[model samples]
Target: MSWTENIPTWQLVLLSIVGYVYLCRVLRYRRLQQKHALYPYKNREDFAKMTNQHAYEIQKYLFGVEFPFTMQKALEFALFRTYGIPSISSLLVKTKQLSEKQFASKRYADTVVLISEFMAWSPEAERTNAAIARMNYLHSLYQKKNLISNDDMLYTLSLFATEPCRWVNRYEWRQMTEMETCAMGTFWKSIGDAMNISYTPLTSSSLGWRDGLEFYEELHRWSLQYEEKAMLPSLDNKKTADETTALLLYDVPTSFVPTGRAIVSALMDDRLRKAMMYHPPPSYIQTGVETALTLRKLALRYLALPRPHFLRHDIISEKADENGRYHRIEYESEPWYMESNTRNRWGPQAWFKWMGGKPIPGTEGGLYRPQGYLIHEVGPKSQEKMGLREFEEGREVLMKAGRGSCPFSIGK
Candidate 1:
C-alpha cells in the first residue's frame, strides 16, 4: 500500500498487469506438466511408430527451426567429451590458420552445409542415400587429409548419435519420447554403417536397436578413462588444446571469452569439469541463466504456442533475408568442386572437356560432339552451363512428385 501510494497511477496499472500475466503463465505451466505426466508410452514400439509418423515435423523442428540453440547444445556436448575435445582441436589446428586471423566465417559455413545436408528431409530412401553419400565423402576427405584417426572417427560418430537427444531431452520445453530417441539412433546407425565404422555399442534393451541414453553413458565413462591415459600425457599438447579452445570461441569478444568458458564449464559434468580444470560460473550468473531458461520452457509448453522457426531454410542465407531465399550450390558443382580439389586448379575448361563438351549428360548420345568455342569461352556463365540442366530437371521431378526441391539446388 505504501509503495502503491508512492507510484503514479499509470505505473501502478502497468505493474499490476505484468504481475497478473506472469502468475497466469506459471499456473498454466503447472497444469500442462501435470497433464503430460499421466499417460507415458506403453512400450518401445508404440513410441517408435508415433515418432516415425511425425519424423519430418520432428526433424524440421530440431534442426531447421531451432538450429542456433540446437547447435550450441551440440557444441557443448562435444566439448564435454575429453577425447572428443582433443580430436576436434587437433582437426581445427591442422585445417585453419586461426592465429593469422581471429576467425573465418567460411569455416563455419562449411560445417553448416554438412549439418544441413545430413538433416534435410526427403523420401526415406533418398534422404538415407544422400546422407550416406555425404558421410562417405567427408570420411574420405578426412582420411586423405590425415586429419583424424580411426578411433577419433568412431568416437565422433557416437557423439553425433547421442548428443542431440541428450541435449534436447535435458533442456527443451518437452522431453523426447523413447520413439524419438530410437529414430535418431536408427538414422545414425545407418550413417555409421555407411562410413564402415567399427566398435559399435550394443544396447541392453531387447528392442533390437541401440539406445541413445545407454550408449551416451557408456561412451562418457570410457572417454574419461581414455582421456586420463592418452589425452593428458603431454604438457605441450595441453597448451595447444587451450589455444584451440580459444580459437573455437574466436567469434566471441575477447572480454567475454572468460564468461563463455565459465558457461561451458557449468554445462559439463563434474568429472569433465575437473578433468578440464574449468571453474563454474559465478553462482548468480548460473542461477540467472537457469531461471530464464525455465521461464522459456514454461511459456513454450503451457501456451500451446508453436516453436520458433528462426533458422533459415537455406542455411547459407544472410540474416537480413527474412524470406530465406538464397543461392545454393551443390557440393559436386563447378566452383564447389574446385574448392574441394587439393591438387591442380580445376577450371570450367577442364570440366567441360571432361563432360565431352556437352552442356548436359546423355545429351550427345555418346558421340564425340564438341560445342563451339564461344560456349567453351563463356564457361559457367553460358546458358548451357555444366550441371545446370540436370539440376533443374531433377528439382522439377522432385517438385512434381510432391517432394520439396533440394535445399542446395542452384539458383538461376
Candidate 2:
C-alpha cells in the first residue's frame, strides 16, 4: 500500500491496463497448448489412428480460429513459392490463366474456393469427397499427358505441408508446437495419397516413418534439395511470377503500388527473388518492412485480444444454399463465384468496393458468375461442362476406399 501510494496515479492506471492485456490476450496460445497436451496425439499409434479427426480439429483451431488471417497469408506465399520453379512456371504460363490479366482474379479465387471446399468441411463430409474428386480428375488429365512429374508434385505437396509451420514460427506471436506440425504433415500426406502422389523418393518411404514429425522432417529436406536444383531463373518463371505478384497487389492504392511490391519483395528470400528475376528492394524499404512485421508480432503477443470463437474466420459459407451452391466468405481482388444477392450487391462493404471501382458481385454480369459455385464446377472454365463421369467415378472410388478414415489404416 505504501509503494502504491508512492507511484503516480497515471502510472498505476497504465500498469492496470497492461496487466489486463497480458492476462486476457497474451496467454491464449499457452492455454491452448495445455489443452492440446491432454489429447492422445503423443503416442505414434494413437496419432495415426486419429489422424484425420485430430488434424482436422487442430487445423480448424489454427486456420479458422486462432491465426486465420496469418495462415491464409502463409498459404498464399506457399503457392507463390511454387512459381519459383521453372517447370511449374512454364506450365502455368501455358495454361493461360495467370498469363491473362482479365482472368487473374478468377484463377486465384478458383484456387481458394477449391482448396477451402475440402479444408473447411469435416473429413468425412460428402462435400469434401466431391471436392477431392474434382481435383483428382483435373490433375489426372495432365498426368496422363505427362505434363506433370511426380517429383514436382511431391515438392508442391511438401510446401503445402511444411510452409505454414515455417511461416508461423518465423513471424507469428508463437511458433507451432511439434504436435501441431506433426498434425500438418499427417493431414497433407493423406491428401497426397488420395491424389496418388508417390513417396518413393523419401528414404523412409520403404521402411516407413515412425510418426508425422519424422515424415515432415524428411520431406522438408527433400524440398530444399529439389529447390536448389530446380528453381532457376528463366523468362517463363519471371513472366508467371510477375503476373501473380501483380494480381496479388491489384487491390492496393495506386499511389502505394510500388511500396506494396517492395513490401512483398522484402518478405521473399533471395533465392525466390532471383528466380523471379526481381531486384532487391531498397535497404530502407526492407528495414521498414521487417520492423513492421516485428511490431505486428509484438502487438499480437502483448496487446491484441484473443480472437473469439464466434468471430472465427469463415473460409467459405458454412452451409450450402437450397440449390446446393456455396459462396466464399472472403476473397481478394474480385468477388468471383460469390452470390449476387441484395446484401452482397449493395451492402456497406459493397459501397466501398464501388468507390474503389472494383467489381461488385451483382454489378458485373455473368463474367465473374455471381450466381455462386457448386463443388464440382470449380476449375478452369473449359472443364466446367466436362469430366462429369470421371468426377463421379473418382468420388465413388474415394468413398469406397474410406477417404475419411485413418490414413495409415486405409490399406491395412
Candidate 3:
C-alpha cells in the first residue's frame, strides 16, 4: 500500500493489469495441475492397458511442451507428402484461399481435439468412438471431394502410422518403449479399420502388434526413401511454389525470407530439398544450426527440469471433475476447441446435427467399410479403390527401396 501510494496513477494502472494477468496464469496452472493429478493411471504400465496411451503421450509431448519443433516436423512432412501429391496440391492451388484461411492452423486445432478425445481416461469408450467417427467422416469428405488418389491416401496413412513414432523415438526427451510401440500400432490399426481402407499395409499375421517395433522401423525407413524421389507435380510451378512457401513461412517477416529458407533447408534432407528445388544452406549455417540443436538436445536431456504444471495437461480439453466426468461446455471452452469452432464453417454443432445422434454409416458393427458413404448426391468418386494386390505391390516397392536403409537415416 505504501509503495502503491508513491507510484503515479499510470504506473499504478499498468501494475494492476500486470498483476491481474499473472494471477490469472497462476490460477490456470494450478487448475490444470489439479486436473491431471486425477488421471486414472499413475504410471506407464497402467496407461499401457488403455491401448492408446502411447499416442496420447506422443501428442502431449508434441503439442503441450514442444509445439514449435513438432510443427516444424509436421510442416516438413506435409510439404513432402500431402502437398506433394498432385491431385491434393491442385485442389489447394485452385482454391486460392491461403490468405483467407490458413489450413495448417485449422488442421493443428482439429488434431488436438481428436487426440485429446482419444486419450480421455474418463468416458474412454465414448471419446474413442467419437474420435473414430470424426475420422471416418473426414475420410468420407476427402473421398467425396475426389481430391486424392487411393495410392496417395495409403501413402499418407502409412506416414501417419510411422512418422510420429519415429520422430518421438529419435528426438523426444524419452524414447518410447516396446509396449508404447505396440499401443501406437494398435491405435492406428483401429483407425485404419474404421476408415475402411481396402487393405491396410500392416497385417496381424505378419506385421501386427507382435512386430510393432520392426513394422514402424521398416515403414519409417521406406517412407524416407519414397519421399526423397517422389516427384511433386506442383513443385516446379512458380505460383504454386510461392503460395506453398508463403503458407510455410506465414507470420515471418519479408526481410527474413532468406534466413527462413535457410532454416527450412537445414531442417529438410537433401532429397526433400532437391525434390522441392530448394538451395541448400551454406555449410557454416548448417553447421551452426546443428551445433545449437545438439546443445538443445543435451540441455533437455540432462539439465531441463520437469515440465511446469501449465504444460502438464493437454491444451485442448478442460479440467475434469473429481469423478473424471467431462461436460460439453468444458470441451467447447478449451482453447483448441474454441479455435476450431471459430475457424470451421461446419463446426461441432453442425456435425452433431448432421449425424442426428446416429452412428456414422460406414463404422457400423465395427466392420470396416471398403467403400465409404453411398450418398448419390456427391459426384462419383474419382480416386481408384485400393485392393489387397495394390497394397501388396506398394509394400513391395517400399521394401525394395528400403533395402540397405539405416534406421537413423534422417536425424534432427
Candidate 4:
C-alpha cells in the first residue's frame, strides 16, 4: 500500500503539522533575530489551496519528461555553486489532491527558498566555510608530509579560500545577460503589417547559404535610419520604437546580433584596446544592470545580491562570430516569448563570454583565452542541407553541433 494510503487520518494530520512547523523554523535565517512562525494556514482548505498550484506545475514539469505522477527527485550533483541542503526525499513526495492546481508545491517552493539563500544570505557563509575546509584539508596534507615552509603553505591556503568568490561573481554577472538572433519573418496588421514577408515561405526554397542569407535578410528587414538614432536628442519627438512594430518577436534578435558582435570585437581588438578601455558603450553596461535588476525581481528570497555593478569594458575580446548569429533563451520556467525575454541574458551572456563571443577573459603573455562557445567553421551537416525556404516552410534545422547532448545545454 502507498505510505499515505496506509496511514491513519490522525497520523497524517500530526505529521503535516510537525513538518510545517519545522519548515517555518527553517525559514527564519537566524534563530536569535526572531522566533519561528507557523505556516499560517487558516484551515485545511487554505493549505490545500496554496499547495494545489505547485502540484499542478510539478505535474507539467514531470509530464514534459513522461514521468508525471511518478517523478524522480533531483540528483545530489552539487553541480550549481550554491549552498543547499542535500537529500531529495522531501522533494519526491506528491500529493494527488494538489495535482490539479499545484503552483507552489513543496519541491518548487523549496527550490525558491534555496535560490534565495544562495543569492542572498549564503555566499559569505559558504565562502568562509570553504576557506576553513580547505585549511583543514591542507593541514591534513601537511601532517601527512612536511614539505614546505609554514608561511608559504599558509599564504597558498588563503588564496584558495578567497579565489572562488571572484569566479562565482563573474559567472553570476554573465548569466544575467540575454541574447537573440533574427530570421525571415513577418508580423501581421494585428502586430503591424498585414502583408509582411514573414508569411511566405516553403521548405523547397533557397538552395545554398548565399541564397538563404539574402532571402531571410529581406524577411527580417530593419530600416536602420530610425532605430540608429532613436535617442539622439534630435529624435526625442519621434514615436517609441515599438509603436511602429508589427510584432515584437523579430525586433530583439535581429538588432542584437550585429551590434553585439561589433561592440565585443572592438573592445577586444588590440588596435582599439587602449582607446575604448574603461569607456565601453553605456548601452551595453546599462543593459547588464537592467538584466541584474530584472533577475532580482524574480529571484528567490535567498538570492539577495546587491544591484550588479558594471566594470566599464576595461577589456573586450573579439574572438568569435562578428554577425552575432547565436540565439539562446533560458525560459524553462517562462510561459511565452515575452517571459523568455525577461530571462534572456542570463544564459547567452555567459555563453558569449565562454565562446569568445564577447568581452575577452584575461590577458596572459601575447595570447588571450577566447570565450568558450562553438565555432561555425564546422557547422552541422545533415542528409538534407536545410535552406531558408525549408525553415519558412515549418521544417526545423540545426546549423551546428558539438560533443555534449547539445551546445545549448550549458545551463538549466
Candidate 5:
C-alpha cells in the first residue's frame, strides 16, 4: 500500500500542518539572517555606536552641506514627528495632507522612514540601539575620568542621553514660548476664569494636584529624586556644555516625557474615551480623529487590542451549513475589552508586522503557539532582548516573555 493510504487520516493532517510551519520558519530565519548580515557586528552595543556615528554624519550633511536651514528644519520637524508609522508611504501621504507646506519636498519627505510596512522596523529604532550603545561608552569614559558621579552618569546615560531627537529650526524653537508649551493643559482648565490662567504657567509640569487628579505624581517624584547640573569638560574631554544643558532640561528622561497626549485626550475627556470604547474603526485609530497615535511610537493598533484575555461568559451554538456539517459559531459577541491591558486592537497583520515576527494580540504573559509540531511561545521580543528604557517597553516585555523563556528549554 502507498504510504499516504496506509497512514491514519489524522496523522496525515498533522503531517501537512507540520510541513507548512517548517517552511514558514525556514523563510523567517533567512530574512532574519539577511538583516543580521547587513550590520557590521554581532554585538548590539557596537551596532548602536555605528548608528550614532551615522546620525552625526547625517547631522553634518544637513548643516548647510546639502540644504538651507529653512528646508532642513521643515523636513526634520515633519519627519521626526511622523517617523515610526507603518504603511509609511500611506502615512506620508496622510501627513502631507495634514501639513503639506512643511513636508511637500519629495526627497526629505520620503527619506523619513526605515520600514513602511505594518510590521517592520522604523528608521528611528534601527538607529536607537546604536545611539544607546554610544551613550554607554561615553558614560564609561566619564566614569573612568571621574568627570561625573556614578548616579549622575547612569541616570544621564540611561535616561536622557540615548533619546532619539531632531533639531528644530531656531525660528520654530523660538516661536514656542513657555506659555504655548505649557498651554492647552492648564489653559484649558482655567478657561472659565481667564484671569487666573497667568498664575499657572501653562508649561509647568509641577502642577495637576490642584486639578484634583494628581496625575503628575510620577513626574513630581522624578523632579524630587534628581536635580541636574551642567559640568563642562575640557577640550581633550568629550563632554560638552550644550549636551549637558539639553539633557538636564529639554531632554528629560523618556520616562518623564508625556508621550500619550492622545490617551489623555481620550481618557481625561470622558466624552472622547467613551466614544473610543464604544465605537468602531476607520476614522482614527479607534474611530476618533486620526491626528496621531502610537504605542510608544512602536507598531500601533486601530482599536485597543484588549489583551489580558477578555473574559466572556457567552452562549455557544452550532449552525448547520449547506453541506449539513455543523460549524461552531459564537453569537451576541461580547468583545470583553480592556484598555490598560497589553493588547490593543490593530488589524490582523499588526502583531507580526510591528514586532519582527511574533503573535500579535496575545496575553500579558504571552501566547502558546504551535510551530512545526512543537509548541512555541510566540510574542514580542523581551525587554531583556532590547534593554528598553521605560514603562511602555516594560509592558511589551511582560507581554512577550513574562511566563518564561523558550518552550523547548525544559524536560520536554
Candidate 6:
C-alpha cells in the first residue's frame, strides 16, 4: 500500500484491474482441480470398482464439458488410424463404402451417428442398447462372411481407448489424470465386450485384468505391436486415405485446401503417413502447426474459463422427436441423419453450402433423407429393412444381460 501510494492514480488503477483478473484466473483453475478431486485416486479397492456409471460421469466431464472440440478431433483421427491398416482398408474398399467420395461421406456420417448414440447416452439406457444392437447386426453380416478378423476388431477398439488420452496429453490444455484414463478404458472395454470382440490377444486376457487401467495398458502395448506388423503402405490404404482426406477437407475453402491437407499430414505420425503413402508436410508448415497448437493449449489452460455444465456439447440430440426418431447434432460432409427443416435448409450455414455448390438437405428429394433417422435403421440403404431380425435378437440379448452392467461380469 505504501509503495502504491507513491505511484500515480492511473498506474494504481491498472494494477488493481490486473490483480483482479489474476485472481479470477487462479480461481478458474482451482474449480477444475476441485472437480477432479471428486474421484478416488488413492483408494485402490474403490477405484477398481469404478465401472459404467463412474466412466459415464467422467467422460461427460471430459468430452462434453472440458475438451469437447478436441475430443471430437481425436476420435475423428482415431477412425483415420484404422484406414492405415491394409486389411481394414481392403475390407472397406470391397464393401464399396470408400469407393466414392459421396459414399465415403455417408459412411462416415453413419458411423458418427451410431457411435454418438451409444457414447452420448447412459450405458444402461434403452437408446444405448438399441444402438449397440444395430451395430452388432451390421457387423454380423461381415463376421458371417469371415471378412472381419478379431485382431483387427481389437486394434480398432484399442485406438478408441488410447488415442484420445494421447491426443489430449499432446495437444490439449492438460493431460488426463490416471483416473480419467482408467475411466476411458473401463467404458470402451464394456463396448468391446458388447460387440463380442475377443480380447484373447491381450497378454492379460488369460489372467483377466484387475481394473480398467490394467486393461488399457495391456491393450496399448498389443496395439503398438499390431501396428508395427500390419500397417504398411499399399494402394488400398492410399486410395481410402485420399478419399477420406478429401471428405474431411470438403468444408474448407478451395484456396486453402493444400494447407488443410498439410495440417492433416502434420497430425499423422511417420508410420501413418507412410502407411497412407502421403509425403511429409513441409517442415515449415509442420513447425507452424505444432506451434499454433502449443499456443492454443497455453491459452486454454490459463485464460479460458471453465465450460459450464449447461454449456456442455452433446454429439446427439437429447430427446426423440414425436415420430420416435433422433437427429445427429453434427455431420462431416453430408447430413445423413439430420432433419432437413427450414432452419437447416435456409440457415446462415446453409448459405455457405449453396454458394459452394455443395449438396444441402432437402435439395435431392429425399436422397439425403430430409426426414430424421430411426435409431435401428441407420446403415447402408440396402440394409434398411434387412438387419431388423438380427437387431431384435441382439436387443433381446442385451436386455437379458442387464442393459449395461459391467461388461466383464456379463457371462460370470
The CA root-mean-square deviation of candidate 4, after full C-alpha superposition on the true structure, stands at: 29.2
Work out the TM-score per prediction: 0.54, 0.94, 0.55, 0.16, 0.21, 0.93
For each candidate, the alpha-carbon lDDT, in order, equals: 0.45, 0.81, 0.46, 0.24, 0.26, 0.83
Question: Which prediction has more favorable lDDT, 4 or 6?
Answer: 6
- The candidate 4 region of ten consecutive residues with least summed lDDT is 178-187
Clashing pairs in 6: none
> Candidate 5 residues 1-412, lDDT tens each?
6869988999999887677666655554454355346535345223222332232223222222222233233433333222211222232334342223322321221222110110011122322222223223323333465544533322222221111111221221112222111211121122112111122322333333222112122222332244222221122111111121122222233464333333223322222223222222323533343233223112211112212212321111122234332211211111111111233335433443345333233333332110100001111112113323332343333333312211112111
Cα distance off (Å), candidate 4, residue 248 = 24
Clashes of each: 0, 0, 0, 37, 11, 0
For model 3, the run of ten residues with the poorest summed lDDT: 403-412
Q: Where is model 5 more than 4 Å wrong at Cα?
A: 48-412
lDDT of 4 by residue, 59-169 (tens): 222222222111111111111101110111111112211121232222232232222221221112332122222223323333455433332332222222222222222
lDDT of 5 at 308: 20
Q: Which pairs, if any, clash in model 1?
A: none
Q: Write the per-residue lDDT of candidate 6 for residues 1-412, one digit (tens) a residue.
A: 5877789999988887678668757876786678768766545455567767668778778889888888989899999999999999998888879756758887888888888888887887878888999998888889899899999999999998899899899998878877888889889988888899999888778778777787888899999999999999988998898888898898899899999999999999999999999989999999999999999887887667677889888767788889888876656577666678888788877788889887777777777766778878888878877888888888778766653555444442
Full ranking by TM-score: 2, 6, 3, 1, 5, 4
Candidate 2: list runs displaced more than 4 Å: 1-7, 25-27, 43-50, 409-412
Model 1 bad stretches (over 4 Å): 1-42, 46-57, 65-68, 75-88, 91-105, 123-135, 141-147, 200-253, 274-279, 308-412
Q: Using alpha carbons, what is the TM-score of model 6?
A: 0.93
**Off by more than 4 A, model 4:** 1-164, 167-255, 261-279, 284-298, 302-412
TM-score of 4: 0.16
**By the TM-score metric, which is better: model 1 or model 6?**
6
lDDT tens digits, residues 74-185, model 3?
5345434455545555654564432123343334334444544544432134445445445445455557777655555656666766666566655555555554554444
- Tell how far residue 352 is off in model 1, in angstroms: 42
Best by TM-score: 2
